[model samples]
Target: MRTPTCGPLDLAAWLTSDSMANTTSTASEDISELIAVDEQSQDVFVSRSFPQRTGNTLRIGYGGCTTAVMIQAVCKTVQPQYQLFSFLGSFLGPTSIDHKIHCRVARTRDTRSLASRVVYAFQILENGSERVCAQASADFHVPEPALYTYSIPLPTIDGDGPEDEHHAPSARTLLSRGIEDGHITSSSANSYFTNFHLMDQYFDWRHCLTSTSTQTLLSLAPHLPTTHDSKPLTARPQIEYIRLKCRLPTPSANWAALAFYMDGGLSFLPLHLDHKSLEDAGACSTLDFALRVVETRGMDFGAWHLRERRTMAAAGGRTLSEGWVWDGEGRVVATMSQTGILRPRGEGKGRGKL
Candidate 1:
């Protein structure tokens, strides 16, 4: 739990420059500001030269990145006294790394201790055409003392690297990379994830999936779990540790970063469950997502957090996945759930290239 650098967000000062909108960009300034909402007007905000966090260079923007941006857009407009507690949204269209999304926030509810807002994310394309890529609702609240607190223990991951200030891949990445490096099987990598595309790792099977306390395994889920309990490839929750690449300069930036990481791992989870990668899918894209903040006292960008993901169910050309985020002290930082399309490779219809 690192402390965020001090200062109230001065989004206006950063907006004076037009170069802040460039899609192909980076900055020496705090990466926090780079990812913060670029306020355009009272209700509108655009990305401020935010570094694209795509797994592939395609027309479809990363749902998690867009979700992070949309959440921050509303966070910018809300009073500083309130903090985000819950968020829900749906992807109605597509977006990409080559575009900048404009988020418009509409206040739907307000009170002294609580507030609610709805956000619409529109991606401005190269030809100046804007499409509604996503829409979401966010709820924020003033701090309140907890009556009682309890959370499931932070399950120990196998030889999980020591926590660092920054620089670590998520659990999903380790699992995918393990498969690609020949731990699970020599299958092609998922086309939708940056992790699945990488061909290297420094760990063996024993380093990632087994221990004495609990036998939590990060293996592939069988296609028919209900009828295949006796099979070795049963559905089990996956665990991995992740951290931001650098420290953010403000509280608002931390929230956006949390959201960005939370929205990830869903698109490729279904494929992983069925021993398939995005390369074996026809449609694999997120349709909707939800996030609930459980605790935030010391949730900082530069600390390692565990993301546990598993498919709740998969059928009828769709899949529902759930994840839990736990801090080093076993605190529940937040909980997330997502629903998306997951068609077989030959179906050749819907969104996502795999």
Candidate 2:
């Protein structure tokens, strides 16, 4: 297998294509960059003009909610004085592309060093029915001199190299290779299944695992450095070195991007380990997503960061999982958690109950 080069990644490229030529947006900016504040309603209207991409198919009014946009709107509502340190979001339902998401944010409490707010994202249907697509509660704090500081030891993973030399196959390339090599099979039943691979194109994931899986698709896991004497971790965490394809300028933007990236494919960690094909079991959909930014500053997306995700449990037709993001220097930047619904393919009608 040849090492794939990391190229520039533009999410807007997926949104703006020959197919979308007829589509126009008052806010033509990328999904990660658009948020309009409405003073009258004390709410924000987020534009979801980005067309949804599923595998090879591109369509409108499809795909999951735009988490980055939700996070951004919440931050924007909170304004600039305080910084986001923690947030939790519940994925109530899918948003409609035909309508702008109405975001209502409220500052519930504020103090000298800390503040808290709740954000509601909903859509009002033509029939005048209101659907709450998602909602989040966040805690923001003023940067204060810390009296204590400590970080968990970073996991030692193989294939450590200078940032430039740590390239891996792009998500598209890996999918193509998976299909060609008979490692991954295609299912036309769900557009979401098709778009799963396409979603990985937004970021670069270089696997740190050096072992073959029992299921044989090369499950993502963390491994100790070759020179380290510590035994390999018995608990398999989906570990990889990740970097965004496009650079987000501010800490808030990066937090939103992290929220977006964190929500991608996490619920499937157990399924990936179980080796059960989606045909046999099913695909997963995020129900709720949460993240805590333990460390706010000095983080750069240009460099690789270790992302370790592990399944907490799976039951009642749902799976719960948690993850941690550690910078290259061994500082833990953020922690995340999520729950998702797992519905088998070809069992029901209409987009697999996400």
Candidate 3:
């Protein structure tokens, strides 16, 4: 990969720009000093700024943008084949783009092959409010020397010549204009994830079922009578449930990979299935999810069908686990594990399919 222009001079210029812009914000009152320079020992630099916000709710937009920029800068310096494997962030208090924010990175380990780092993103509001908007620890694996190699075959797809093939529109396309365009040309009145989604030529995904149908079944099931219309039943009937799965394929890259085993179980029912009526009636939540990386194939982007999905276990308001596999062409490939929380939809929703 090409190196990014992020030397000491470039860093200085970036900080200067930030400092100049800060003069007009409310944070300027609280910021007694602003400074950023390279740290030779760790081969990293620190950027500090002051911010001001009214309440304790950190602005998610500014936080995400700042975090992305900070990560990109550090990665450019470290030059790791870095991928966003996992992210866990929370808003502790209100923050402003102009507030005094300090980004500090520390190298935790450096071996012959791999390196790890911890990043702390701190914010100080004008009202003497301090918060840590994001903190992350990441590990980078060194690239191994290539030797003998083997790979699974790519998946098969019907021929509709590449030019005539009908490609499904991705959520990115449906929501934002291409990155080249600076405006939000698409409708913003959509689901949060759909509005700010990630799309890569590196993977292919397909939906096996509609969200509406799944929601309907989940909503109506609890209301169904345990016994016949008029009969008094001794035992309550068991609820029937189905697992929905999506198939994924690896895109052609040196390393074909996929983020598998996302802990959707936590959010699966409350976020997607549970309804207000059921919550009010004191119905128990369902815990059911399982995913496994089945096979590995050669690095390539090809069509892969979701074979089947079944609930492996469900008990005590907690789903066991879910697994996902990426097929490189025809052979099974990479995998990942993830955990999520169910919450009301924020800004992006119902805009487009993932």
Candidate 4:
């Protein structure tokens, strides 16, 4: 991959240029700090070689490459000209942080209204072997006249900002909801398990199902739900309000951001269905993710998106879940589905802990 000269130092100059003055309404200084060049959240024109990999806890030297980031890298190549309407990606393997990811795009099909492109991501091993980490095919469409449009009703849920004062649910909300759904039990004092939301720094999530009531500090750890005399029902569909900490420039960028957001948390739907905790649930990772853009008429990055995720099926160590993203006004933004692998802990041992 060839590196681009538009680094952070050149960003200010790009923003003040006459070209940008005609594009953005918001001032450069007023822009959200969440914008990153390689991430494609802004309009500053970042290229392929811009750094994407960052530090990871694991010393494998390969940094984490998120599904969303990889998708964004591909979408940016055709942004503005054609907005991404659909994407299907397969995560083949993990890449090291030490090596830069190389994205290769190929135009597969095109017509007057729609176009398709295939993307492949690869990382060079220390031994100089190029390992394929992800492959994706995205369909884009040009703006055209539509005769009719409709969207299914969104489940009743609270959103962030304005009257709500940006109070999205913390990790405690997940534990509370898990308990209410009979999927989680309170952990014993000896259990070192804790809510992971305390470490969250980006998106704010408001879990509508369990947010109506408050939870105690002692109530936050994962525990096995108790059984009833009669067989318990399956876990309810999980719903939450997810909002980005920063805003992006275009609709394509927003969609890319949504891709990143859905890749996380949604995969746990299967564990919720089986009433299992992270420690006992075994190892889990997203194998593939597919997203469809239902309508983009009024998609806004600044507004809170209602994300409703539910498991469709799970068997043979694999799980499938569907997630819907809607804007604050109830306009459906996008629908996402993911397939994940769940290996039950024990049996032997796995690389992923809890």
Candidate 5:
């Protein structure tokens, strides 16, 4: 299948087309570039470039991208010692990629060891109207001695993992590789289940021993969740390796990159476990997210890390997915949770980040 190319200048042309692809640059982007926000005034910030939309051409703005930028914008107003520890937010409405974004930061609280910030993002429309797109509450904390420490062990898996020769820089790389092998159409993006025009340049992901079944979440004994939370196989688990395509200049930039990376495949984790794709669903979109960075010492976006995710629940027109990221040595680095709308087609509901 053929997918259309959209360089930086392709926005105008994309806005006029009847397509489900985003008007996003096909060229790869670094995390710093994607999160770079220009200070407009005391606490307000503006985008240096248009915030990117997800692969879904239906114009679903990437919720993670907005969250990442919000985190960065908040970082600018906080003390250097206080790093982001927690963030809770929701996508307020759909966003247009054709316009720049403006962020307003509110200093909610400030103390010696802790700081709180509330951030709101708005799309600066062509007509000069500003519409609220997303909002988030972030907490920053200075490094402190741990009073107690404990973490679940990484699951053991039986299969060729990401270290094998079959891995690529991103998950979608496998989809494109299919085109090279003539297994899929090389010309049209329409033939694919999802689009990755913008994300292919930001991060690399390597999948490992992916499976879903009863008894074992992946149906493998070694790969069971070792936590006390495990209740006789309640969810499907997926494992992958991830790293940024380029180094982020600051620790704050690295944190934002993790925010973006963790948002992947969340709204559709259920479909993924069913061995299905977006083609099997009417529409899916993340409604809310909560993230907590466990440690502030190792802020390395350029290094490889292990990421594991599981579907916590799916019901009542929404689904929840939880994820954990760990350093190469198996130390827990961060945790992310998302709830989203997922349903069959013909529901008459619109599709996009909201």
Candidate 6:
């Protein structure tokens, strides 16, 4: 199919059109610089671009989340009865806001009981540098008659009964000022982060006992070096570096099944110079990012109180592999695995190869 070109203005027009609908679609225009919707045979196509530089850090607004939402949207558009079984993605490269992003979808198979598709996401840079930023393949299974049936006992929380008197905090409060802000002193916020996001979802996460301070949790995983860090430091470092290590919670039941469910939501952030670092070198630009959910479970949202996150996996002088997501649970929600012509940040891409 021919490459589609779209801009911010085009997105505005598309949003106003009656043919395009969905609250998520309406939110897309506000976050992205360009958006394109197309039809290819029985499948649909959606692409978007965002400014590369916003303030100091690379700005990737709700676009990453919107992309995931759009994939489910496409599935609903094509097959209304199908439920989202799972999703998985791998980050291939960095997406600059100065570049245009193209997303293409093609159906690989559609049968009575299952449907699968391949999605390609890439960016076209200003200097004619084109790279595949992210690639994803997904399978959506339709329920049918099976030989075996099993179910796990759902966890018990304080508000399980009719008069439990438990009230969930608003999404904004749960995300922005609470977990994302690292303010866990509030009882409601702590419960939402530790219990609601984990126990409710059937997954358990235990923080390191020594990490009782906010600084400890904030430094759980440090960002790796970007391409520009090749030079020697001219000034002495002012602050000391600290590290924290924690173990993945062991599943008491359905371990393997839960592993498969948890594996797909793992994502990582690559090291790259922030906007301030770039500006310090006398260059100002926008950075854009895209991520795909290769695998996930229905309880991901309910179990993990993920607030906000940013990730990248870059190496050498080129953008290699990366992934990012926001979870209110303060833990990794979705795992993203990427592969392409380029090698990944640390090792080769697709280490999990799920």
Looking at candidate 2, what is the lDDT of residue 310?
72
Misplaced by over 4 Å in model 3 are: 1-59, 62-74, 80-102, 127-130, 145-206, 210-270, 275-354
Least well predicted 10-residue stretch by lDDT in candidate 4:
22-31
In order of TM-score, best first, we have: 5, 1, 2, 4, 3, 6
Per-candidate local distance difference test: 0.62, 0.58, 0.32, 0.54, 0.69, 0.33
Tell me how many residue pairs clash in candidate 1.
Answer: 4
Off by over 4 Å in 2: 1-31, 34-41, 51-65, 162-168, 172-194, 197-201, 211-234, 343-354
* TM-scores for every predicted model: 0.74, 0.73, 0.39, 0.69, 0.80, 0.38
TM-score of 2: 0.73
What is the lDDT ranking, best to worst?
5, 1, 2, 4, 6, 3
On the 0 to 100 scale, the lDDT of residue 66 in model 6 is 28
Model 1 agreement with the true structure over 1-354: per-residue lDDT tens digits: 111121222223222335435546422244455456678888888986543535444434456667778877898778988889999988876554455677888898889999999888876544455567788889999988878889988765545354321223444454456565554443323432343221112111121232210111133322313322343322555555666657776667777778777776676775555545566777677888888888758467577677777778777888889888887787889889988887776554634332
For model 1, state the Cα shift of residue 197 in Å: 8.9
What does candidate 3's lDDT look like per residue over 1-354, in tens digits? 111221122222322344435555433221111112234334443443333322112222223233332343244344544332333333232234454445567666667666666665555444443455455554555545557544444323323322221222233342232222433323331333442222221223332222221212222333322222242221111111111122222111112112111222222333223223222322222122112223322333233422212222334433322333334233334332222222233434321111
Give each prediction's root-mean-square deviation over alpha carbons: 9.7, 10.0, 14.5, 10.7, 8.0, 14.2
**Model 4 spans > 4 angstroms off:** 1-65, 158-199, 211-219, 224-235, 273-275, 352-354
What range of 10 consecutive residues in model 1 has the weakest lDDT sum?
198-207
On residues 112-205, what C-alpha lDDT tens digit does candidate 4 reach at each position? 7778877766655445555666777889888787797778887754454423533444555555555676554656321313223211445665
Candidate 2, 250: how far from true, in Å?
1.9
**What TM-score should be assigned to candidate 5?**
0.80
Q: Per-residue CA lDDT of candidate 5, range 1-354, in tens?
A: 111121132333434445534456332355577677899998988866666666666444576778778888999998788988998998776556655667888888999999998888877544445677788899998998889776778766554455563532234455455456544454543333345545556766665634342212221122333332243223556777778878777878888888988887777777656645676777787889999998767588788788888888878889888889988767899999999888787877544312
Q: Candidate 1 vs. truth: CA RMSD?
A: 9.7
